[model samples]
Target chain A: MIEFRHVSKIYGKVKALDDVTFTVGAGSVTGFLGPNGAGKSTALRILVGLARPSSGSATVLGLPYAETACPGLRVGTLLDAGAQHPGRTGREVLTLGAMTLGLPRTRVGEVLDLVGLTERESRRTFGGYSLGMRQRLGIAHALLGAPEVLVLDEPANGLDPQGIRWMRRLLRDLAEAGCAVLLSSHLLHEVEQVADHIVMIGRGRVLAQGTADELSRGRGLEETFLELTAHTDRSPGATASPGAGAGRGSA
Target chain B: MTRAGHHLNDIAGAAPSPITKDEKMNADTPIPFRRLLAVEARKLVDTRSGKIIAVVMVALVVASVVARGAVVGPKLQTLVGTAGIALGTLLPVLGILTVTGEWAHRTALTTFVLEPRRHRVLAAKCLPPLLAAVALSLFAIVVAVPATAVVSEVRNMAANWEVQPLGLLGWTGGNVLVAAAGLALGALLLNAPAAIVINFSTPVLWAVVGRLGSAGAALAEWLDLNTTATPLMRGDMTWSEGARLAASVVFWIVIPMAAGLVRVLREEVT
Candidate 1:
């Protein structure tokens, strides 16, 4: 249960997000797809209360995410897998999160196990972990509190093939169990394979959104995505133009 | 499915873990302040930089006391006062590190994500260093007691154990004020190198300004914490001296800390 209502974020001359709106219902996986600088990360940041929106609002479970009691337990998020302190052991990082959320210490062990990090690996400092290990640790941290909703950004960035498949199954399983999952990624094909619904964005505007089959038609999701985003110029100062919000990549 | 996926499938495919589902349905309670304090306090000594600073604090205290014993025969007041040198000078650096470390390490995102109330987080961050100042002041006294006995016995001098409780309180209070100044500056800047440099450099600047004339010297009495704090550490104060100390504390600790709190609360953690 996540909703973005007419949300717009402007930083100086750049409109990072413009009248963007979307939703991910309970027991569903909504893949938020966009190119670089497409405002995906900016929108997620606003949703999690890291960055304030210039207009409108975003809410989770009927309340702004920051206002919800024990938000860490109600809504889990992994905006940047590398946001952890490098000097801390993976276990220590998770333990602190557990402490912050008032969760049992065993939850740390369970999530560490769920994310496929071994006890030995968990004991090692985060600075020494590989990028894939960081992603796992981040995922473990997101799941540590048993949240009802997950807002993840590029969760599969450093994962191997196996790790990717495991993540797909985990998201699917979480959705099956009635967790709302909003996943953002650049991997169009992976989004096609796992996402129950798709929202395509380009240049801070929603380009298209529907079930995979409906949006892809017969041409497949990748070609449709490229065709939709290709007409929008991806540059820093392009947001000020009158025609920047052209619908569906109209040239 | 990959090998890891197969292993996790048993847990994943079997629907949500019972614990997770149960907890999700359980009552929504806010994070307790005690837990936040414990977490913030643990973060202080958890890093390599944090450990290095701590070890340096201990070493400086020991070195100062032993050197005092060698040079001045370890009088009780001097021994205790000398041992506080490390705490007064460097404990604030520790305070600076605790605040700036969150920004330097990029853990602010994670911290804010878990607990979005920035003011609550700031409040939690502020208390640990003040507590450390009190603890370390006592620790310095603890280390000085043994050093006084051992050093006096080695050099064939009697150890003086007579020091006023008021004097000890003054010493600890001054150290706490200095540490609070450090915390305030760190929060104001949110950068370790910048805050630490500014924290150390302001006193030197004040020393130079104090040499300008009677006006500069008078200004320093109200602005330079080092000058105003002397009477405080000596356990003697007139009403005028107390007022001056209060003025300097406001200039050094209160103003910066209040401004820093506003900045921290309004800051966007991107």
Candidate 2:
């Protein structure tokens, strides 16, 4: 499981995250929704120990992510698909990750097939891959460890309709297999279709969080999300009150 | 509880329970150091840039021996001198690439993510370049042996079989030192082009300054890496000369590398 408690991140004078808090648990798919510049990436980066939080805590399995020892075996993260060495073949990239996790090389081929990357696709260097191919490779990288927790930010950005459909099923299956899955996306429909739980943040504050039925209120997911986050797009700092997210985070 | 109130319980409640001692111990086992070194080595030979630099280094070693053999009618050690310069100058660039490539290509995210302890990663990067320097030195000997015999055969000159084992070893050591200096500069300035420009230019610019006067010569004696390394490479240095060599290496190699390590360790991955 992953948890962020009253977390805040300040870059110079800018408060990227403002007293934000949430948790992701086993057997659940949580959609992390926020507008651009709303600290979604910062929060995810902190959760994975890629960035440090100015105050409060981000932990995996009850310890700091950096201190978790075998982190790859406990949690998997995909912050960006373009962060890999472009000259390395897709197969070599997965092999590196698998080796880091101490898994056998055969697992590399299995993950390649699972992500729908054909033998031919895996042979090419990442520089030649289209955005869709990069996304698949990134997914394959995340799944290489088969950890109980998964964190992915904007993972479906460049995928086709068919690819997106495949991803939705894959994530759902992983969650059903008792993994905690947290993903952030601009695709509300995709989130609505797959998310068992939803956590919405606006201007670095938790606007709302709950089960789909509870958040929808019989009205629908899109209307509730836009209505809550509309004020944030206008001015991020105006809503960054100290106690702003307390009620939502508590829930 | 109200729906919002109950949901807050999930947030507060999901804080991971305390891990057992066994679990903590399990988590403590980091990836082995040997594996990290192996990965760093593979990265050196796996890319187009790495491969190109390697080919250029090999060609430089061979070309120098051939030129000296034909023109100077060289002995073994004389042939070794030309090979040393060619290898010494170029291998440092390869060493620089090993550290700065991850930063330039933004592959640090993947590398650091897999091995969060930055020091281990840096040490791993230093490993392959040092080995390359040693291997290049050996290749120089391989090329020189044949070139020496060919020069003697073609020109009807005596093949000077006289060899100084220590001088040859010292020359190889000089190349290894320069390779390390390159890595230090690369780590200190985590950009490939910037590190490359600075690493190559420092010695040349210092040489020009060293020609000015007595004060300039004094400064060069203590700090100019190329000048200090020359006598050391020939294995003809006195005790005082060895001290000067040590002093130069301290400034060029040790200090920059120490600072570079501190910066790399503290840098945020984002």
Q: What Cα-based lDDT does every candidate model obtain?
A: 0.84, 0.80
DockQ of 2: 0.24
What TM-score results for chain B in every one of the models?
0.91, 0.87
- TM-score of each predicted structure versus truth: 0.93, 0.89
**Tens digit of per-residue lDDT, candidate 1, span B151-219:** 789999888888988888999999999999999999899999999999889888998889989999899
Query: lDDT tens digits, residues A1-251, model 2?
Result: 88999999898888888888888899889999876667888898888777888999988878888787778756777888988778889998888877666666777776787778999999999899999999999888877666678889988889999999988877876776677999986567777788998888877788899988999889987667766766666344536442433333221
- Model 2 residue B111 CA deviation (Å) reads 1.3
Which portions of model 1 show Cα errors greater than 4 Å?
A235-251, B1-27
Q: Interface RMSD, all models, one decimal each?
A: 3.8, 8.5
Model 2 TM-score (2 dp):
0.89
